[model samples]
Target: MSLPITKSRFCISYSISKFSRFFPNPSSLSSFYSQSPSVDVHDSQPPSDDVQDFVSQFHSMFHMRPVPPINQFQKILGSLAKMKHYSTTISLFKQMELKGIQSNLVILSIIINCLCELGQMRCSFSVLAKILRLGYHPDVIALNTLMRGLCRNSDVKKALTFHDKAVAQGFRFNEVTYGILINGLCKGGETEAAIKLLRIVEGGLCKCNVVMYSPIIDSLFKDNLAKEAYDLVTKMISNKIMPDACIYNIMIHALCKERRIKEAKNVLAVMVKTYVKPTCVTLNILMDWYSLVNEMKSAEHIFNTMTQLKVTPTIISYNIMISGLLKNKRVDEAMNIFQEMPKRNMVPDRVTYNILLDGLCKSGRISNVWDLIDEMHYRNQQPNVITYTCVIHAFCKNYHLDKAFELFKIMMKKGIQPSMHTWNIFIDGMCKGGRLQEAQKIFQYLLIKGYPLNVFCYSTMINGLCKEGLIDEALTLWSKMEDNGCLPDTVTFEIMIRALFEKDEIDKAETFLREMILRGLMT
Candidate 1:
């Protein structure tokens, strides 16, 4: 039976467990000794006496002297692996090696499976080689574990290579093996190949299992190949295999991505009819999709329906609502949702603050946004790049250049580099303020930094000079703008025409107007 952990004891134990390996001295000596006559490499390996004391300690801790049976040891290792006791795994593997237990197929597969599951793929492959070197048959499970790792790392070709080799070695494909292959092929958009593989499995001597079909359907969904996914679902049912929640969720997500809301709802209905329950991931897909399409009301409805169906929304679900409301310009509603978050027992993350700031900034309420920022700081929430950028752009729009610059400096201090958008805002503001010389310095800085001055920047400077009645200067800058590889916008043409006319240069004005008409910039 598992013992209950109190809060204080848990905290103490957690810290104590962090240094768990100080007791397990694997290497006796630590410091490298070059002058100590490079210890003669032994042709024969050292004896196990070095680890005998720790081996006995392991036995004492468990109150067992004899090693457990293969299955029993497997169960214990599985539990340890699940607990992510990496040190324990390393220790056990080492002890097993020392005992000459021989890393056979079963043991190697189990350890490799655990390592692969933990994203330690390198170690898994090392064990694979060790098993092979030991002259033992590397089982299908071991090969499958490696394939799963390769697939996870998006190394599809490598996985396929292993699959071919395994199949050649009389390894019949299992659900996991096919699932990994189908997932990789679907993700890689090798749909034709995936279909071909399916045909091969169908025609080959190996019988098609119910397990392989789910991932193929799920992969079809992943690729937004909804029709294929739907057909596969039908095939699963006709095969007398029960469609699981995973298959249903995948189809629902596919329908959502395709913006087939009605069909998505239909899929959900079928899921319910089949007595398959929707998990949090299923509801999240719906809510997130609805949010993406700006259908906040529908998103909220689905969220409510999810709760009614006993599906608890994770923090991600709430974030979707907040984000959708903000993007739809329902700032007040977004804030209301944020304010009432504590009522639902949810804490505000950086995303929550940034979303609120974004809505406020876009609506031209920088003062309130500043207040919100202060409140966030008061609440011990730090501003991130999104928050800083939003506030800086807001300042630039309100001609609060000083404040915007301050935030830019603060962002740099926080190790958050200002993006091109941030630079554009300041440049636009500077041009508008008749600070062309300062703007020119910034322009050059941007150019040297490899950031091209976008069309807006070019037009803004030209328009600024034109408004100042500096026709010659504006024309010169316009030519320099073109030389810098900045394309002239429609606004740039209009500004040039206006500048020429203001200077009473009638001929030049007519010439500029002709260019504008020739470019089809204005009707």
Candidate 2:
């Protein structure tokens, strides 16, 4: 094994000696040179700040008389790799190589690690070839890093083939080896294979941990195979391994999403029984689910229970409560909760402000928005594009186009770029207000800016044209919509069909209705 560089034997002296011939003031660094290098090959832990500082100084002396020791170069490169500065590490390694400094196996592995991180799997293979050419046996670390890269790139099949070859060659694999493969396969939608691999680990090929099993369980839940996921949980408990709160949270959220309230509560009970305390996120998930299904009473009860259990409600919890109340049109209750947020020492975020604005705007309380905007500014929560967009949408809804245009100007002055949603809102509003020429100008601008126009945009424009008794113009837009790869939805088809029939073009309406049925969008 390669050892750490010592104060007595660092090749830095040759560089300093060469530098001293040009400058008389090398004395300041003399005492620094006496200190030992901090990074050691045997220390498998991550690099410290001191090691990084040392590497910085080390790289600065690259042009000096003597090249750095290969072990020291490897240590710095490894540290850089660990810090996720993959490109910098690779560059340093190239400098080492150009100086004819022969890299050992450890340095070769670091190079592989860097290459893998950069997603340059092809280049990583070239390094492996060079390792073999140098007559250095490639170690498991190098192989594992390569597989990790492939997994990251979603090339699980190639990773598995390489892994199988290593196994056939009698290369011993560890938990990390299995973890990488299992996680990759699960993410790649090969959850069934991932579970089969997990069984192999359970069969004594390797030890299974939460890291290996969690992804599989999460995937199973996404696939709605909750029963199979629960089976794995039971097997895990039988193996004497306790699942983490995250695992239980996944199951709870999935069950709650499917409206299995009783089962979700049972899972929560199991979490409490297992001594895995439910986090604020867990309670928030339940609260959000109840709120979404319009079970306001149950949602309120859960929020109250959180306070009783001394689990402080998060901003998300408050947002959910306020938004839910507003969604149910209980604006007074939402405002009460909104005002209560400050007493809890949590300032309202942009979402909170937006929700309040949306409710106020819909209720024709546009005057209240200015005060809320002032409050947001006081809280240092600058309104983003969504905030401005919501307010602009309110103006459009109230038919105050000039005021909406004024706010749009202010938003631009604040350097906030309007999103595609903002453009869509403006176009829809103009179309509804019978400003067909203005709407057409915005639509043409959207096309010029390469905006991905949605079905709503197409439907709105076509509806506007048809309402203005311009049937030919609406048909031309429908053709362009299809040709530009924006598939018309049922609403789009409905608008066109209604327009064609209004113009007494029965054949086209019949043809489109048939097309809609064939596309399975209609029966």
Candidate 3:
């Protein structure tokens, strides 16, 4: 289903090479506009109030008795670009040219950036050629924008070739230039290429810095090359390129992911000792990890330390604490934190509500769940699929199967499609509650509806059949699971084998156990 990396890169490069040849001439901006497809306003959402106001102001400025200076036009264009009204920006640029307004490098570069953002690479290249035709030497920013456009198109190889040509034309680039190229390489899964480029640029005109090294390091960690990433950091230190908060955060996050808490702590210590202040993100990462491993005391300490360090805790910070406490069954503590959020001027988002609601549901505090859901509505945070799923799960857990089914129908009526997990929870509930026939009906319905059933879904049904003394039916479902291409996992095999052994089918149990081992599903 996936192309080989080499073939994928070659395809991208080849496609880019083909498009590179069709660049419109730069002498006439009108010709360039003619070649490009006109931006259809109907295709995009209507502009916001602020954007509308800006457009009115732009028109007034444009039709003035004495037009504003080029810098004034540039400012308006830059602001529009920042607002992500790329099409509008390009249209306004055309207006300026038609009015015979002399264009500067800054204005041209802005147009190039807008084109790049709009994915009009051919138009972007045409703008670059215009910059050259007007005897304006493209600065590092202009060339960087062009290369970034190439990279954004997934033509990193073409970007490299462009970089080589720029160097040949005697144009000097800066650290930002290399940063874009390195980032592109890493994003394209060319970490080794990024490192090699970093080596080539080190101690040269554009000395390599954290900006250049961070992406490669992060990519290395993602590829599970922890030692290589660590060594790269050491090399950066030796070269006096001190790691900043961003760099330290990357290291801490990666180490925490690997469950290397001690190493993560050491990195934090080094970060602090070196006077690199830990950010809110750094503290949040530690808090999340501690909470996950049930080290609530450590999580609490980090939460408190945020204020001491003058790092303002964000809504995310509160959400993490609440989720963590609730996960560890500290429902009351979570509720306390949730209540305290308003005092801190933080409005709880949907995720906050879902976490607390699910906790309350699991804790059998069903009485207060409706009140919280009403509060969500009052706050304009309407319950979505996850919210409905939580309530249904709670009802099912409390043996209120009728209420669960009722809520499921209400969810469907409200156009909230049930997720696979929702179906799984409901089916598992029915099976455990001795409603095997209902579970089978729902399972069959899911299959008929073409749901991409996973091993867990099939295994759940098979387990239910076996428990209901339908061994032949369970065996049939097991065969159907494999034929459907949902291969049995270790859990599925263990469930089947255990069910068979309990039913005194020792021969079938041993046969399944041997097959599971042979398939490497079990050790």
Q: Output the number of the TM-score-best candidate.
A: 3
What are the runs in model 3 whose C-alpha is more than 4 Å off? 1-19, 22-49, 84-88, 91-104, 118-122, 133-135, 374-385, 413-416, 466-476, 487-523
Candidate 2 per-residue lDDT over residues 319-381, each given as its tens digit: 999988988889889999999988989899988999898888877789989899999999988
Worst 10 residues of 1 by lDDT: 5-14
By TM-score: ranked, best first: 3, 1, 2
Q: Model 2 off-target regions past 4 Å?
A: 1-55, 60-83, 96-108, 130-139, 279-284, 294-391, 403-423, 444-455, 462-523
C-alpha lDDT of candidate 2 relative to the true structure:
0.80
Cα-lDDT of candidate 3: 0.84
Weakest 10 consecutive residues, lDDT, candidate 2? 5-14
Clashes of 2: 0
What ranges in model 1 sit over 4 Å off? Answer: 1-123, 135-139, 204-232, 241-243, 254-259, 289-295, 342-345, 364-383, 433-437, 498-506, 516-523
- Go through the candidates in order and give each one's C-alpha lDDT: 0.69, 0.80, 0.84
Ranking by lDDT: 3, 2, 1
lDDT of model 3, residue 201: 75
TM-score of each model, in listed order: 0.74, 0.66, 0.82
